[model samples]
Target chain A: MVKNKIKTVACLLLTLFFLGGCKKTFNQPQSNPEAVFNELWGFMDKHYPMFAIKEIDWDKTYAQYKNRVKPGMVDAELFSLLNQLLFTLKDGHVTLMSATDTATYLGFYKNYPLNFNLANIKNNYLFNDFKKAGPVMYKIVSNVAYIYYASFAQNISDAELDIFFNDIKATKGLIIDVRNNTGGNPANAEKFFSRLINQKTLVKYEVIKNGPGRNDFFEPKPFYISPNGQTYAKPIILLTNRLCFSTCNDFALYISLLPNAQIMGNPTGGGAGLPYNYILANGWKLQYSATYTLSPKMRNIENGIQPNRTINFEPQDENNGKDIILETAFNTLSLE
Target chain B: MIKYYSNKTVFLKIGLSLVCWLAVVNNACAQTLNPDLYKWTFTLGLGLNSNSVIDKNFSQLPYSGNGLGLSGSITYQGRLIQQQLNLTYGMATLQNKYYNSLYATYFTANYSPLFCLNNASNSAFKILAGPQIAMQYARRNYSGFVNNNSSFEFSTSLATSIEISYSIIPIGLVLKNKIAVPVFSYMQQPAFGFATFFANSGSQNSVKNSSDFLVPNKFYRIINNFTIDKQLAPRHKILLSYNLDFYKINTIREVKSIHNNLIVAYSYLL
Candidate 1:
């Protein structure tokens, strides 16, 4: 009986021990901001792909900025960090612009420029490189010149551009191809427009700067002039597509202002903005819109520069070997 | 009188022989039965309170106040595979003067396979491996001039763990060494993944400098434990355990080491 009693006591002790071991006490909860910062910093140190180019001392950066962050530093601080990080890419194509700003920029191109069609050669559209020798460039039997400007970047010198315009002035009609031009500088488009119009008129007004900063001024700029010492006087057609954007749309708009110019093809890509850069506390950089532009008549152009004569480039046209839009332009010019 | 006495002695001897035979048979039967062939153990544990960055950044600060944690588990043993199921529930309050308190809870299910190293004793050493699925729920409450607000969040996760354990019946004690590791889907951030991994890995030095943004500052501890369980009755058991967890944490925020922290818990099995 005594032995049995001892066994019972031993079992009781063991059960008590197990129950005690599992008992837990809760601790008070609180926010540790320094810990939070360190955690984030450590993750970026190990996982960020562009850590080398970013050239940031994560520890020091966090330590320095953590103190400055007071309570209620939520979305504003997050946006600042994102801006800093994206600026390191340094690509013009990469940027942040509000939807409203983008809309405003597109609206400036709608009323002024004309659009037209350019001939396709060897499956390549030639609007920006009409001078390049290939099956892409073919002079028609009517002595009409058809040019495709793929991009505004094709550096056609001012003198060479004038000579090309002079050569095409007497043709039955001119087809300025901008089907795929995304855009570059508005000045380039203005120069091309000058060759088609005789009137020296202000096509757009720009405010270079606001406030008491340097180079702040509001001025009207002459958009087009006859460079051959005479206007084309004949019908000039501008071609565009959805890929036509930025200064390319500006070109279409400016050219459309001429009495003899007509816009053909699809709508332009609506993106217009003058970008400015800002640096964040973390040494990251970001670019955003700083200004807006408008046509001379104060019309908004954010939606896109619409074509005067809407023509669809059908898939069947390619299979049938017919330049439907260009032929329509020619027939219209011939009637005139 | 002589005849009667002789008959009584024979009867006594016969009874003695029968009793001895029964004892031998019982001993043999006990020896033949394998203890390792089948085992069922139930465990209950409680964890101390903690806070995380997700709680701090998205939710209000002091996301959890002093709170209690509860967990229970059942395991089955086979020659090569051991199956286990676990359930856990925890609640904490967010204690702050300015912000209102918050509550959080989690539930998990796990399946593990056991690998035995020896077949010699009823008490043997085994390794366990398996995956676990978990669901978490959280709630927040606010008061004062800023206006009262309450919100709840739900999430699901998967985890894996490896554990080594020894059961010895002579001393009526069982010792366990366990490690847990977790892998997360890409939709979740890597910081959270690292935290989950470290929380289960049971590695003190491995995750000392780990940048798991989601883990609370107080959780950076490596837990090493020694446990003693004694069977009180046929179905009742008592357990006594002590654990030392290493924590190394920012001292400026709280007067504590950021690593090598320690916590102790005790439980009874029914």
Candidate 2:
């Protein structure tokens, strides 16, 4: 009886060993052109939070673009058709990426004046003698600190900021020029903002899509920045332009909440939505704004944030090897 | 040969040689080495793992790929009980139908105790049953998705385990098969479109909110291991093992993952 039981047990284990671990395969969406188009449209319809904000009738967009995507259409034709479909949103945050190329809307900053001239600033203001701390390029121009922050993508560590603030202790005021900063990591901007605030300050509000309904959204949640690193409480002028976008826009908005800071230059290139990405069945990636952001006054600041004072760049002044925006920031600091 | 030694001295040498030869023969044929003397063992393994995952929250298509990794274990083998602790880490890639790949990494630790059913018997076959506790953390990342590209899970499971081993005396080999099924688990999976803000929130509650206790119907896991052991010396062994793990979570968005591994290891008996 013991031998029989052992034989049975061995056979049962062998059977189980052979029978297990079958790979599961899920039905993939068809790789046809029309099917790809429908997948893209359906995802955007369900998850894209800015269709209502951008005043787009997605069903009408589907009606207009659906016929353009045929079953036998090639990849290039399908890509172009999808590009046209995405263009109606007029959002800088939206993009379509394939193996060969990436397509995005540049009208946010392209149609406006190129308010920033790097060569002019480099030649005259932030000359070769300027000092670098993290992503910040700084030099005292006429006793006022000129901090030319080109992009928010580069990190400014707390230690680097401490060194930067200590170096500029003798300066009368600071000019923070974020003219062409298209945006990078928001945490970097938050870290930079933390130096200007003494207490926890509510900077903006954000709402996310929770349901598939066109109007479905979570209540706007408050975003705050608290004190961190070395505090610089001196008069600071934040310069902006049409090219300042994403976290650059966020930086400008946060600086406006500080009593010692003033925003100069044109309205910001607004891209307030938090972008999210999805992959289509054909391996193409589609990114769109998935959340809405509001200014402190509960106003829609997606188009752009208005500056406290408007400053413009001058080509004539560029011919003289000077950036008029920097001069304007200097004059504003002098008044302070 | 020569009269160099007296007959008495020669006889003494001859008697001593005979006794030594007989002792050697008796020791060689005895086969009475006690395993209980060497109860503790340490094993180090190198393996390759192939995985297939279908996470509807991340994507509808299944991502399948393989990777190479290493594992280490410590085991105690008493006369009628065995216990082991195993730790493993591996990195792999999961590719969709369109050839897009997501980077996957995983770490696991498991502890099991088995009681021998027929340890007192002289039969070469043995059966053991016990419980296993396993904890695992896995994460998948894709660079293409800017904000919601990463997804991760942490699970602690209690499982029923059984092992069967048979010794082939002629070849001096032992073959063992073990299987386990998780009865219940505490698992955490993020909500749809796992937000980047929550990842940087630095709040423990955010992690707790995504966790829940799950039963068999909602969370199912199974593990099967087959191994061949050869005793190279009284204090050494070489093992070849194959292990399979299958896990699935049924929620608003269902996710299923399977791992197939083949390992070669060396065990040192102490």
Candidate number achieving the greatest TM-score relative to the actual structure: 2
Worst 10 residues of 2 chain A by lDDT: A19-28
Measured against the true two-chain complex, the DockQ scores of the candidates, in the order shown, are: 0.01, 0.15
Against the true structure, candidate 1 has what lDDT? 0.45
Write the residue-wise lDDT of candidate 1 on A1-336 in tens digits: 645644554564445434433433223333343343344344333323222223545556666666754555554454444334334432222343322221122223344333332333433333334354221233433666776666765545567666666667668877777766877645566566666766666565332222222233234222323343556667778877666776676677677677778888777764433433322222122233333345667654433577898887567676565566666766776666
DockQ (0 to 1) for model 1: 0.01
Q: For each candidate in the order shown, give its overall lDDT on alpha carbons.
A: 0.45, 0.78
Off by over 4 Å in 1: A1-120, A123-140, A207-230, A279-285, A318-323, B1-270
Interface RMSD of each: 20.2, 3.9
Measured by DockQ, the strongest candidate is: 2
